[model samples]
Target: MDLRAGLSQQQSLKLSMTQELSQAIALLQYSAIELVDFLENKALENPLLHIKSRKAEVYQPKAKGQSQKSNDKAWIEQISDQRFTLADHLFPQIQDMKMSPFQKRVVTHYIYHLDDNGYFTGNLQDIANHFNFSLADAEECLAILQRVEPAGIGARTLRECLLLQLNRQEVKNELAERIVSEHFSMFAEKKWKQLSKLLSIDIKEIQQVFDYILTLNPKPGAAFHYERASYVIPDVMVVQEGDQFVVRLFDHILPKIQFNKDYFASLNSYQDKKVNDFLNEKQQDYHWIIRSLEQRQKTILNVTGKIVDKQQAYFEKGPTFLKPMTMKEISEELGIHESTVSRAVREKYVQTPFGTVELKSFFTNAIESVSDESLSSSKVKMAMEKLIKEENKQKPLSDLDIVQLLKENDGIVVSRRTVAKYRDQLGIPSSSKRKRYD
Candidate 1:
């Protein structure tokens, strides 16, 4: 055997994590909505950050004894001023429970350590070590807090969070409570048949319990603060200006931001090391905020531009002309990652002349039929809904019957199951539910 080695050809690209250029490229791929949010959050967390808005400029005139201009810069401030940390709420409850001061202190520390979702990310041992308390004592405090008004608060696991909530609810029977506590996994997975057999209950009864379970607040601490609210300030506003479409960001109420030049200028004269350091840090923060805002604007423009380019037909002809689209396709065309496209669409909405719509709603995967023509799942679903709406309620169509009608009458050759899925997606109640009385 020959001992000589052969070389193989390979090419690679290097990426730097710390460089702002790389970060900006990463931000570009983010949907306009995501980029704005990410930048706004960064600005809020950093004291040195500033945003320049036309609203701010108008406000300057008002400060000089003038009227408020409609085009004033809307300074994007923190959502809320009240600082309601989890520790503030939980520690008070622990104190009121008549626990020892040591236990209360331990509980306070634990609450501070919890994540936004109210889960203890750190292990119990690490928590105990941080406060010099035994693991058992730390756990006991956690247990008490878990049972508080927000039942899921301070839960270490999802199971515990759910069970705590279930305990507080008026279940009215042992069976419902047991099913929720012990068979939650089965219930969630929609293994209705299995649950019925295991619990020795009828299928309809099991389904009723399932419906009740679904109504519980999964994240009890979700509404703890205004900051945690799911808010999306649209990047692009598509309004009908006569016969054409116009696009702009909806930044009406945000504040205008600028550097405190007087403070910055004062920093130059100061000889104190700490003051200079603070000014320098603030200066860098200001730069990041300004750059992030600019990047957000550009990113939104780029995404909206692409969306308009690809979906021109839909804009002109309405939803029926919406082409098949996917995150992967958009990512490939834009030369970015799929996750970035997903993030851009996630929680981001577009205010069109027709109505306010989530950006992702414009994109739907197509299902090709035997005739070699492709139709969007959304379009198919719409067609199915139309058929159902026009169908005779006295003799409502079955899933298979709908499938045949779609193929023979509407030229959409989809399976019965596909019809069923589309029906469910459209929230078109089944034949049983749609039955009418004389």
Candidate 2:
């Protein structure tokens, strides 16, 4: 053993995490919207940088019998969403009822407290205190509000909502009412055997009750809660030219960068060293930003081009034709690090012939096939969905049974656990829950 304390210089290769490099890495992962915001903030900090944003084009529908110039209208004027909201529906009903002014005021207060699900979410005690009344009086006002056209409009609970709706029916479903009132927990949890024995009814009748319950909206007021539609901006666009797909970066949707020449020239003519240093530093920052943006667009174009090439069949046909792919595979093909490819695809969407889809969705996990070839997990999921859709509902296929069916029918061998995982991913219930007596 050599026990000696000595100082020696050693040279080893290691990548430096410079601030500019970090900014580039961050800029690579930012989506179109995020990138625009980042540039706008950066412009405020650096005097040498200027950001110019390009607005997305809105469609102007062809006028039926008018000339183009005469039919031309402002884009904002053309955009309209006159949706009837829950508040609109409730206020009219409140006005039609003949009640005392104070009573109407109390009822209006109760109406304001309801959530989007039409459930009374306000505290009765708090409301009572605010109105200088008893809790019983507040509840009375709530009851009056509940008697409106929408039977379950002012219910405090799902059970109360269902029961209120049931009570409003001329031909009452007594069994449903009892189940919701008493065995709500068991019925909701799909413990039909216990529920069947407790209610003294056949499992078939319980299943019928289950089927009826599905028709009821848990969020009744959700139908009336209208919101503005959100729009998606694609980072890349793929166009089909006969049999081949061409990839183009939608970089114009992002803001354009320009050097603030007048500001730089004016500031640079100063004699102060500090002012010159600041301007020079800002100039470097602006140049680096431009370089990073170019690299970002190039990287996105390359990655999207590769994705289009790999998923040609998918673009031509649909998602059913999506092949098994991975970021590691793309990284290897592009001779770049996997993380670079991952960042490039992160939070990015590509516009295809069918529709716009998330760039990350292009890569599907591969499953080993019986013939020693890999199968796309998406394909397996699709096949699983078809099997479950066409299976006998009375004796629904178990996960193991599905695994066997996939092996026999699709020539793809997968574990029961994998099948269960895939089933869960597809939002399909377990066999026991899926099974029905009727």
Q: Rate the local accuracy (lDDT) of all candidates.
A: 0.70, 0.89
Question: Model 1, range 266-324, lDDT digits (tens) per residue?
Answer: 67798999988888887886786578667666556556667777877777778887877
- The lDDT leader among the candidates is 2
Error of 2 at 69 (Å): 12
> Which residue runs does candidate 2 get wrong by more than 4 Å?
1-13, 58-79, 98-103
All models, RMSD in angstroms? 10.4, 2.8
User: Which residue ranges in model 1 land beyond 4 Å of their true spot?
Assistant: 1-85, 129-134, 169-172, 228-313, 324-351, 355-374, 381-410, 414-438
TM-score of each: 0.53, 0.91
Q: What are the per-model numbers of colliding residue pairs? A: 12, 0
Candidate 2 residues 1-438, lDDT tens each? 978998899999999999999999999999988998999999999978998888767766676877776666555477776888777888899898888788899888887888887888989999899989999988888888888867788999998898888788887788988999988988888999988898789999998888887777677788888767778889999998887889988877788789999999998889999999999899999999989988998999999999888887898899888889999999999999999999999999999988999999999898878887678999999999999999999899999999999999998888999999999999999999999898
